[model samples]
Structure formats: C-alpha cells, structure tokens
Target: MTFTDDLKKENEDIFQMIFDHPFVQGIGKGELPKEAVEHYIKADFEFLNAFIQVYSLALSKSVNREDMAYFHEQIQFTLYDEVKPHLNFSEYIGVRFEDLQGHPLPPSGDHYIKHMLYHANMGTLAETLGALLPCPWTYLEIGQKLINKYQPTKEHPFYKWMHFYAESGKETEEMRKRLDVLAANSPVDEQNRIKDAFRKSCQLELAFWEMSLTCETWSGELAVIK
Candidate 1:
C-alpha cells in the first residue's frame, strides 16, 4: 500500500476505536445522559475556538514563503469544498464566535474556526498532514455513528450536514493522498516546522478541552472580547 494509504488506514483504526468507545456510542445513539452531553458539548466548543487561533497564527507566520503559499491554497480549497458547505447549525451553536454574534453560536464555535486556520499554517507537508487528518477523520466517524444511532428527521440540520460530510469519504481519502505527496516534496526543515506546529496544535486542543471540562459555566456570548 502507498504511504498515504497506510496512514489513512492507521487513522481509520484509531477512529474505529473512538467510535466504539462507550462515550462515543452513547453520544452517537443520542442516549448520552444530560450530564454527559453537557460535558461533551462544552469541551468540543472550547477545542474549536483555540484551534482557529492557531491557524491564524500559522498564516501570519507563513508570510511570503512559496511553500507556505501552496499550503494556504490547499487549505482554502479544503475549507471551501468540505467544511463551509457542510457546517451544521448545532455545530455552530457550540462555538459562539464574534463572526456569528448576532446568531449566537454554541459556546465553542469560534475555536473550531481557528483550528481550520491552524491546519493551513503547518510548516511541513507532513505537519499539515498530521493536523488535517483529524477533520475528515472526526467528521466521517461521527457522521456514521450519528446516522446509525440517531433518528433525526429530514428537517434536522445535523442530519443533512452529517450526510454531506459522511458521503465525502472519497474526497477525504484524496486529501490524505495529496498531503503525503506534499510532505515528500517539502524541504526537511520545512517538514520539521510542520511537525512542531502539529504538536503545538495538539497541545492547544488538549488544553482547550481541559478548560472546557473544568469550567462548569461561562456566561455571556462565547465570542472573544475585543
């Protein structure tokens, strides 16, 4: 198998584990107790908020470099093609970013936006690959579980959104392939930069989750204060 194939396969394995985990199973089936759903929602919100900030930071650091330029383009395409088109209202509700202040998104919606930006700024192709892998993986796994477990009506926003993301399985696989090629062609130093950035991104995600779990409540709109 190609390197990308191997990488995707490994990701799938982990995803499967997550999917089967008791917590995921509960959430997917819409059987999460009120307490569990509350916890999950809060944690997810915080993760997305910080994630977007990291992306913006990466973009700022990218400056005028050629390789970084390409990375930016690829990320933009991915967002346009995959994410923007499939964002569910409930997903947005978790993140209350200023961009949607009038709409009042969830507590953690902005953070999710920042995470996407983070993937765009990863220095090396490999680093980008590591960062980007989670998007398709998380969505695909979650969508499938929701489809199997949840009985949402056609009018439910999440049902339609999840269907769109879930059906893009081929596109997700293609992205992984492209990332592998990008990694192979990137300079060694650039790859290292990507790797470092990926690690930082992961740390940010973890911390965000930790905060969300610890903070029982955050009042006002989740949007950042200017």
Candidate 2:
C-alpha cells in the first residue's frame, strides 16, 4: 500500500467520525443550518486565503518543471474556480465578501492554516504535500459518499458544494499523483514525518468541522458572569 493508503488505514476511525459528524450528515440530508453554513464560509474563506500562500510556497520548493506547472495550475484553480464560487455563495447567503474577509479566523481554522503553512514553508515538498492532502482527499471521500446516498435537487443547499468534490476533477487527480511521487521518492525516515503531517492534518480537518458545527468564535462578549 502507498503511504496515502497507509495513512487512511491508520486513521480509519477518525475518517469514520468525520463522515458521521453532524456537519457532514447535515450536508447529506440538506438540513444544515444556514447560520452554521455561513459561519463555515467565513472561516473557510480565511483558510483558502492562507492555502493559496501555501501553494505559492510549494511552487517555490518544486524542483521539477511538471511539479511547478501543477502547483501553478492548482493556485489558479483555488483562486478562480474554488474561491469564486464560494464568494458567490456567501453573497447568496447575505454575506458580503468584505465581511468574510474582515472576520477573524476561529481557533480551529487558525491552527489548521498555521500547520499547513509551517510545513509548506519549513518542511520538504513531501511534507508540504502531506500536510495539504487531507483537505481534498477527505472532501472527495465524503463527497462521493454523500452523492451516492443523496441525490441533491436544485433546491438543495449544499448541491454545488457536494458536486465540487464529488466529481474528483483533474486538479484532485493531479494532487494525488504528486503525493504518490513525493512518497515514492522520500526516504524511510522522511516517510514518518510525512505520515505524521498527514495524520495531524486529518485531525485538524475534524476540528474544522467541529468549529463550523458549533459556530465557534474568538469573542468573549457572550461569556456568562457567575
């Protein structure tokens, strides 16, 4: 089995928890609260902005022309295809792009992005890829499962989001191939670091879902006085 496969096998329990999480189940059932979804959009926008920088860092670290081109293409996709639709959706849900841009990152989202950036900037390309893998990989996994069980209609709130990852587009395949190549070339000692990054990223993914589900924020204004 490849490192990706091994990582998945090792974290099967977390994967199951993520799939069964209320946030994911709500998407499948088309019953996720708009407020919760809005909160997620805000936090996700922050993550995406940071993710673009991670991609830039990856591009800088790439030695192969093919890898460079691939990272460039992904950056374009994230900026144009991925983020644009989310921005439009946010507007549809009565959220202005400026507001989302101005919103502070929640603790979970902040930690996840920081982790990705740290590895992307300081670690090897393999580790960067490992840190980056869980977002798309897990989404694709959940998207396929949800799409299989739920045939979303036009009115379904998450239909577009579901389809985005469910289709497993060219970009997703490119990412998987890049990860495979990195894993194959990496030394046995480095493989452990890559796997560690992958596992932690998966854990962060779950935290992100929890953050969205609970609409966690940094504000202390709502604290109750004893």
Per-candidate clashes come to: 20, 0
Best by lDDT: 2
* CA-lDDT, candidates in order: 0.50, 0.82
**Candidate 2 residues 55-155, lDDT tens each?**
99999998889889988988887777776547645655776766666467888999999999989988999899989988888888898898888978767
TM-score per prediction, in order, is: 0.52, 0.91
lDDT of 1: 0.50
List runs of model 1 lying over 4 Å from the truth: 58-125, 145-161, 167-174, 186-226
Cα displacement (angstroms), candidate 1, residue 142, comes to: 3.0
- Which lDDT value does model 2 have at 19? 93
Candidate 1 per-residue C-alpha lDDT over 112-139 given as tens digits, one digit per residue, 9 for 90 to 100: 4454455555343356556655655556
Instruction: Identify the leading candidate in terms of TM-score.
Output: 2
What C-alpha lDDT, on a 0 to 100 scale, does residue 190 get in candidate 2? Answer: 87
